[model samples]
Target chain A: MTRTVLEVRDVQKSFGAVTAAKDISVAVPEGAVFSLIGSNGAGKTTFVNMVTGYIKPDSGSIRFADRDIAGMAPRQITRMGIHRSFQIAQLCNDLTVEENMLLAGAIHGASGPSFLRRAHDPEARDRAVATLERFNIAEHRDRLVPELSGGVKKLLDIAMAMAGDTQIMLLDEPTSGVASDEKFPIMDLVMEALRSTGVTVIFVEHDMDIVTRYSERVLAFYDGRIIADDAPDEVLLDPEVQRYVTGTPA
Target chain B: MRSKLFLGATAAFAVLAAGSVILPDWAMFLCAMALAKGLVCLGIVGMMRGGVVSFGQGLYYCIGAYTATLVANSFGVSDIFLLTLLSALACLLVGMAFGPLLSSYRGIFFAMLSLALSMVLYGSLSKMSVIGGTDGLNIAAPTFLGWAPEGRPLQTALYIYVVAIVVIAGTLMRIYFDSEQGLITLATRDNELRVEYLGASVRNIMTYNYVFGAVLGGIGGTIAALALGHVDPEFAFWTTSGEFVFVAILAGYLSVPAVFVAAIILELVRSFSNLYFPNTWQLALGIFLLVVIVLLPNGLGSLVGRRKGNAA
Candidate 1:
């Protein structure tokens, strides 16, 4: 059996009148490509946000490796080997792709301030180049992120997160803005590259085909609760899971 | 790239040295004043890179000027370079103390807080009689090493000294802005959240630049005090800080060189407008600034940058 890298136990979060998550418990094994699928406001994003330390959950615990990461800041969690990418890429618009990648590589290695270290030093530059090459974004090294296409920016966003030494990554809508035909290819590239690194990935996805094709384990959320959790084929074919997927009555 | 920058700096130094020898007294004096103010504006450019616009830089300027002036008054230490360096170092320590506190604020809040602090300094300076009070204090005629030149020789020597200091400081700042730490300031402005998640504390970086800028302002004030032969509470006034902010805006945050260009242009305009319309000189400046901002939101450096991009 694969060693568990992240375990969520009864994690619950709410916003006044809205419940974002409820009694969500799951165990993601190391090196597994885990995908979350649900309808609008099904608490998938909220779950990802909590696990990645963007929001403090109302109850329950988010343990990464062995330590509880319930109340940590995003930066603290990132330092502890948990990182996330936004639904829309959160990138420094004016910085070159290579600069952005080097920053990630530097952050991945050094826990302290990097005031004097050159961003294009041999190690960082080589790592950034290698990550870019993996994401098929090496040619856009000098191009500013704001100028890149949405598809390329999405890919670059993932590349930046991967540039770091992360054990688990929470990707919020990784393929949200990409064209339908391009979604599978993007996920395929991300999963394949990360597989070699032995990193666990928990991604929120909307496409059923891509979800089934890539994810070893699939989870479906219904009204802030995990209603389905199993192998992709089994979970996707579950009767209650189908109802949530199609937004139909029981 | 290093060789090219080195060559450019050498050529710049040669031109400035030559200008100091050949230029008329009035023009040389004007250039010296502009170069001093240019140092202060360069510091503002550094902060601007980190998404901050301070309106209290006059506080540091006041600290440097007053420190240098009081030292000269009480100790009779007249070596200009030594006193100036000592004053700048003191101001840097003061800046580092305030950096973390100031880094907590940004946008208009940061601007206003800085303005309020400088006003406090101005009020205290005006009330204190020990430092000359409302009459202000006069810094003695400073000597370089052991030589004290008077008349035209003094003017020429002072101009050459000021130019050398400005050139060396500006070159060092250029090297800094090109470094990894410097490039990260721009990124911090662009996205503070992303910067934090990337494992660099935004506050730490901002604090670093803030203290660095404060030191530049201090050096500017020291040079100005030495050249003008006076130090006053008026140096701590809001209007003084406003002029530095104005120059920063005009220069754009694109590069270190832009700050000097903008400083020179500002001095020229102020001199000309004051000569022709002394009462409405500020009005003239306001109108000119409006036009520039309307036409080039990124400041004049972007224009130069675009031209270079096209040439390349």
Candidate 2:
């Protein structure tokens, strides 16, 4: 059996009277591509946030590589090899695409960022450009981030998260802002780039078609609980998942 | 590009140093004071890059001036170099103490908190009678490594010294602004959340920037105090802090050199306006600021060239 990379057991979180996560428990095996499917307030993002250390679970443990990582700051968790892309692309609008990539490389570089070394030295530029090329966004590297299209911004956001030695990549709606026609292509590029590195992928996506196509395992969430957990076909076919998550009558 | 900047800085330093010989003593003194104020403004510019404006940098400025003055008076140590170094060291210690707390704040909270701290210093200094209270204390003319010069020669020596200090400080600041940590500061200003998520500590970056600002402010204050031959509570007053902010806003957060240029311009304009209009000099300064803001929203530094494509 493949080793478990992320193990979430009895995780619970609440916001006042409303429960955002209700004893959510799941174990993600190494190199598995998991897609979280849920309706509007179904705890899908809460799960991602807790795992990425964006939110603290009120109870229970989240273990990554056998170490409990609950309540750690986002940066600490990120340095521990779990990285996430935001639902809305987080980019430095004033900077060019290449500069953004260069910044990421500098931040996650082996020596860490330095006060004496130039940030955009030739080596950093080359590495940034190479990453941009992998995402097929190298052509737009010179353009400022604000000037880029929504699809390009999303690509850049995910690309930046790929910096350093990321073990598990959590993508929060990787293709949310892209045009309908461009979603599959973007996902294909992202998945190809990620899969080649053998990093585990967990993406939160609203598109059922994309989920069915890309995810090896699917999780359906409803009212702060996992309603269905199995392969994509099995989960999609589950009556409760169809009823609550996909809004389809079984 | 680095070589070019180094050459340009060298050329500028040479011209300014050369000016001391030809210019009148009053002009040299004015230039020295303007550059001193520019150093404080440079500190503000440093923090501004991290997306925070400090309204109370005068706290460090006052601390620096007072530290230098107290050391000089109490020990009869009149070396300008030693005084400035001590002033910087004092500010560094104070900055380390306050930086973490201040770094936790952002936007107007940081501004007001810093401003409040400076006002507190101003108030306390105003009440201290032994330190001369509202009248403040006078500083003896500074000597250069045991070589005490009086009259015109003294002013010229001070002017040359100020020019050299500014050149070195400005060059080091430029290098810092282009360094990895400096770019992180710029990125922090743009989107602090993203910076944190990228595995870097935003608080640490902000704290470092704040400490840098404090040191720069201290050095500037020491220079100003030495040039004026006086240390006063007015140095910590809100209006004095506001003037440094004015220069910072006028300079923008772009090029390091633009800061001093903006400072020199403000000094010249204020001097000429005070001479010509006397009563309406404040009105003149206000108009100048408004005009510059309207013409260059990014400040005078934007005119140096759009900072794009890693052109620094």
Candidate 3:
């Protein structure tokens, strides 16, 4: 009885004469690991920006949990339990890792029912520490973000998005630019963490290995449009998707 | 750690109050001026930390002075409390009218626009015959509630300093640095896109920051008017805005209380330079600023808390 958690219907966006996303539609069911894989300039991030309310679409409707979130502000979207991480891993470079989690926890935990008093409540601190430990970076929690390695910073970024009891999470290129050896383990941790939380997850990724490994469904975007949406194997085998990923058909 | 921090503030307050009592008239004057200026600089601190540098505070400062002066002169009203309240209301109205416009600009453009707007006010005041024009209007030393400031200068200075420290440093500054929305302001400064992804509107945050900074500037302007006992278009000049910005950078924007310390030091230096090196006072101040900027990129407060992190 898992419900369709997020639905984007006929969304379209453009910049000047360039169309970024055209008549795009997507539906992510509850607790599913849905992934969109495209090369650079394939409009994946643009679609994400629209869904997160960072950019207004030229036309379309968006809904989450039967609620129209078409043009809602990002803060309102976040308050509705949808949180996102960035492709660049926007760590608070000045603050410690623990402090970053504390801020995220404060944002999520302090919402609704005694929101102001909950700000000074002691439980928020305990929750921050526990979330840090979940990412296996708890030992370095006290260290500044700039001091952490790229992989560790990414881990902390994902950990922050997970701090609140969010039902849906959108991560842009979760493992981009990570050292080759660190990639699988970090993705393993991310997938394992999301699985345990039962959070519906959608992410933009480039690597086919990671996509097939983590996602139940693969969404293929080529020229600002969803060309194929199916099981990873089916999408991988599709002629158009294969042509888009690797030049020329075999 | 929090308790220790509170204790340290208490100790600093006591020492400053005691010094005010023991110092000569000139020293007391410098301290009172510093406190008033420090209170105004809090608005700059709030604005800068939110990643916006303002050069329009002269507008609020002038608003406060003119409101108080007009009331005391024309209405023949002499109640200090009543004057402050009226001036504060005037500042709030100005802020409300200007907030949306100020919120529309950012970076150097915003700074220049604010400076231009304040200069317009300065120009108007300088030419207007209603308030003594360029010569400026004189104001009598206000009686607080009922007690006159003539014989009780120390008591009056201490009382105003206490108010400045408590209201400016304690409440408004606290909201700027420590609130949840405060953290969001930092987030907006660091990465607007990231904050948007987290579900916060960057535009709304900037507007709120503008309004808050304006409110603080208004309060500080009102306090300065009462302390100086004068109203002049000169206070709204671009140079006054520049001085506020310079002190903000010199003190570093890390802690709110640091603005007070920076203001006090600057006023003391100004006074001493006027006394000993009257011919090249401005040159001495310029060189001092250059040295401070070169040596401490984070400002004076960074020297105090260098152990924690780099300049905030």
Candidate 4:
């Protein structure tokens, strides 16, 4: 079972006059931290969105867990053990951290008599507590998401993606807008929390330091195309990659 | 804790039932009608909690009343329970038919679309000949399980019946607000996009909520029709739906019991203003709404507490 978890080949997408992804290909291993680095409008997010079924690639194939899911709905993709975390931490701000955890888990956990069933059924509650504890934010269990600090919010966002049987995750800028001092710790906590799940994570990030530190491999984007794909150190020093990375303060 | 809630609800309902027995005829009538209004407003609050402020709830309310009236007139069936069920069924069917279209909209679009649909119903009711047109249709005296009581006994039985329905419904609604489906409804208000990522169909969930709201609203309307012994085009009017929404906002969309409390307070406020100010009663309602909106942005429930995530 050395098969790739996700495969994207010759994917191309354009919005009227603007091309978001052009002649790109990627194959993520079963369980590895793969990072994408690019500047604003460099198509990193567009690529992630396409993989997660938010945007249909103009021409290409996207296979996940042995199934071609190129044109599926976001919900359908998520139900197939794939989840996406937003750049700004798309959480139910009106709900408590515990409530959010339970709500995320409720999708595939129970099905019948939703009105009569307890949302945080004993099993779901235990799993929620376990997830919160794993992310090291159990202290904020009863706290509203709006009351959370940026680091915790980011971690919670990723943790929510892990609440289900998420075999693959597409995290878009998990550390964006986070406090500089807390960024590494948040990423470290996320890595630690999700380590046991053996989840394959594909993250789009702008921070070179974070990309080099946590990711096993890196994909650098330039002009809506992948210019470099190798080990973090090799891709970091590549002349073409350096020009894109050093030229813009992404 | 669950037992405590169960017991507390039971105790509160017992007190209300007892109070209705000891109170005079006018007070009992007021309480019965207020409970019905509360039920309708509760449905609005249900949608309100999901960030969907519907102004077309009057459609279901009117359907509920008219369904009961039609069945009574057409088939001479006056069983209150059966009439309530028929009204709920009618609203459920209509809600299912229209829910898919309306669920895709949010904010002002959702609100205006709902208002427009209810207005369509209102216009139809005003022009229909078989449904008594603008003059409205008359409902025969309702019976309970083949026993049609007259005068005091009738009022007493109906009061008990209303109390039972409200109490049971309130309890179920409480359970619903805590359930996963209910929590997602609240979550839909927070971020529908995230709800979709969680692998739940946002529109479908909202549609179910809308249909549930319509069902309860229909039940409320049927109760009102039976209590008043009349069904009219005015029940489907925008103003009537506005009153339900106003009460929902005033109540803060906080809890099930709070809905009943808000409706009773609203009815009392209207009754007192009409007695004291006569022609300016509507003006008083407007002023009260303004004051409530300004003072309690979260509605009257916030006065107690605004605990985070208590989007009940």
Instruction: Highest TM-score: give the candidate number.
Output: 2
C-alpha lDDT (0 to 100) for residue B14 of candidate 3: 71
Residue-wise lDDT of candidate 1 within B1-312, one digit each (tens)?
556767877787788879877889888888888888888888888999899999999999889899899899999988888888888898899899889999999999889988898899999999999889977899888899999988888888888887788778877776666656765687798888887776667888889888988898898999889889998999989999999999999989876667888888899999999999999999999998998899989887877643111112
The weakest ten consecutive residues by lDDT in model 1 chain B span B303-312
Report the poorest 10 consecutive residues by lDDT, candidate 2 chain B.
Answer: B303-312
Interface RMSD of each: 3.3, 1.6, 4.4, 2.3
Regions more than 4 Å wrong, model 4: A108-113, A120-123, A248-250, B304-312
Give the range where candidate 4 chain B is weakest over 10 consecutive residues by summed lDDT: B303-312
lDDT order of candidates, top first = 2, 4, 1, 3
Name the better of 1 and 2 by lDDT: 2
- The runs of at least 3 residues in candidate 3 whose Cα sits more than 4 Å from the true structure, single-residue gaps closed, are A112-122, A247-249, B152-176, B306-312
Candidate number with greatest DockQ: 2
Q: What is the DockQ of candidate 1?
A: 0.44
Candidate 3 yields a Cα-based lDDT of 0.76
Please, what are the lDDT tens digits per residue for candidate 3 over residues B1-312? 345556666666676767665777667766766776776677777777668888878888787778888888888877776777787788778777877777767899889988998899999999998778987787766766776667567345545554445443544465446556666666667666656555556677676666666665655666667667777898899999888888888888676667888888888788889889999988888888899999988788776644232223
Separate clash counts for every candidate:
0, 0, 4, 0
Give the backbone clash total of model 3: 4
- Report the lDDT tens digits of candidate 3 across residue range A63-127: 89678887787778877888888888987776677767766776665452221232323576677
Clashing residue pairs in candidate 4 are none
Candidate 2 TM-score, C-alpha based: 0.98
